[model samples]
Target chain A: MGRYFFHTRDGHREIDEVGLDLPDDRTAGLEAVRYGGSLLADDPHILRHDQGLRVECVDDAGKLLYTLLVTSVDAKENLATFATEKD
Target chain B: MFDRDMAPPGMAIFLAKLLSHSLLSTEDQAAIAALPHQTRRLEPNDYILREGDRSDICPVLRSGFAYRQKITEGGGREIVSIKIPGDPLDFQSMYLRTVDHNLQALTAVELTVIMISDFERLVQARPAIARAVMVDILIEASIGREWLLNNGRRNALARLAHLFCELHYRLLDTGSGGLDIHKMPLTQEQLADVLGLTPVHVNRTLKALERTGAIARDGRGIRIADLQSLIGTAEFSDLYLHRDQP
Candidate 1:
């Protein structure tokens, strides 16, 4: 079974997963790659999806710093999560 | 000359030393031990290395904090990882191609220099240590992937929780022990730098966490009032942290 989860730092949350025979394509995983550069960037911003699963980077005063797009996979590595920048 | 008191406090440094002895073996460790002591002090915000620099040595951090950041072509900076006291910086660069990022100090830091020539020669002389070093690099890559997941999919709140949990486990792995409270040295800005959030948002999220009793905040530190609950809140899993099994 493949399960993935994502949410923000406060209280909001979202999760999804698929086991064998579950239909999915590289599209979702590829979407995860979009944020790669932004995650690597040093500013703060928030990145989320229609599902409400989100990732944001902020400072001490609650100001936005940078942003990232997070994704997960259950490949041979067991569980893999990737963080990317939102820019 | 390197001062004995300067090494950072963590498993990363010990792991390096372990590799030095276990991987380098008795004769090689003796050789390295015999070499003249060399050390360097970094001022706050100093760059120990930059992208495109030759990776001639893999430094074992003895004291202070540093982080890994990459500058994009458009002048954007992305912070990938932080180095605590025991961590070794640039091991990946040394073993691989040209450095693709910068290693910069978060505070005035000290580094115990391990010359690449000596290290490589030692590795050649001792395959076990080389293997250990290789394992460490792979572990780093896995951590990178997890950070990516934290940034890509997890919401701001979950991301923060996950980061805290991750740090707690890492610190504990290094023999760092305390109660639920954690003495975090990172400012919100620094947190945002790593988590890819804004200071304002970071503050708001922290406030929410505090209000809910998942965490407590003071000036520069934090109190993890509920560790298990916090982990559950973050939906964190420790499989990727690479701690040695008991």
Candidate 2:
């Protein structure tokens, strides 16, 4: 098993000093995605204005393994343009 | 007659836990000490009891920590309760036919395993011990109810703070008189499972608690920096623990 750190950013950067032990990089990638989902679930307002949340997974040697990003797009302007095109 | 000095290792702590909840007479204590039992040790992640397993022995945790958890169909685990040293590992087996949840060691654990028949005989012969056992089970259920409220209603910060406060009080009640506020036993992943949150959220909440001066980081573990502040943050009450004897 290897130790992996998940550093996060959501308008603020929080460096993870204590890392989790997992079997491989694939598992670390899944963990990063889970972390990003949890962040968004806890506070969906971060995605209100197209702002994004990021989870960066790094190994014990400070090597990056995976990055999971969660964001949302405002589709109201796109819908208006589509309506004009239809007209 | 069983000599107190010759009692099995970890027996004193188990007796002390019962005595804390109910007054056990000298005879009752002696009967408990005289019960036939064997000591067994387990490493971390070792399963003491698995779901749906039938066993005739009830194990009392003599030292180290364990937890009860349930797994969902999707393979997600939810930890229901944390067991400390001196806690009875399987009181339900005395009356129930099958185990309901998985019990695993969170650290290197030592357990005093007693036959269910022997325990049942002792409980029938002694009324005070029976009362003590009942109180212990009731208190565990009460803690479960509080955990439900903690996970369903409280925020992450309050949930973490409340858990630490509960642990502090429980360790103090063990009567061991050696409560180490620094060496917390649960990992972030374990804490997340307990609180119904992810490890990332657990980490963030721990940092927030540190900022409030309720706890401080100590390497991989955390120290209870300010108990009063933590209690205030959790809005914790000891009524659920039922430490005071009636």
Question: Which number leads on TM-score?
Answer: 2
List model 1 lDDT by residue over B1-246, tens digit each.
433234333223545434422344445444445443357898878999888888788787777778888877885567899776666687776567788788899878888777777677766767666776677677778889999999888877888888888877765654444326546656676787788774445665677677778788666668788888889879999888766531
Per-prediction interface RMSD in Å? 11.5, 1.6
Candidate 2 structure quality by residue, lDDT tens digits, B73-114: 998999999999899988888879999999999999999998
lDDT comparing candidate 1 with the true structure: 0.62
Q: Looking at model 1 chain B, which ten-residue stretch has the lowest summed lDDT?
A: B2-11
The TM-score measured for candidate 1 stands at: 0.65
* Candidate 1 Cα errors over 4 Å, as ranges: A1-87, B1-12, B15-36, B176-182
Model 1 sits at a Cα RMSD from the real structure of 14.2
TM-score of chain A of each: 0.24, 0.81
Q: Is the docking of candidate 2 incorrect, acceptable, medium or high quality?
A: acceptable
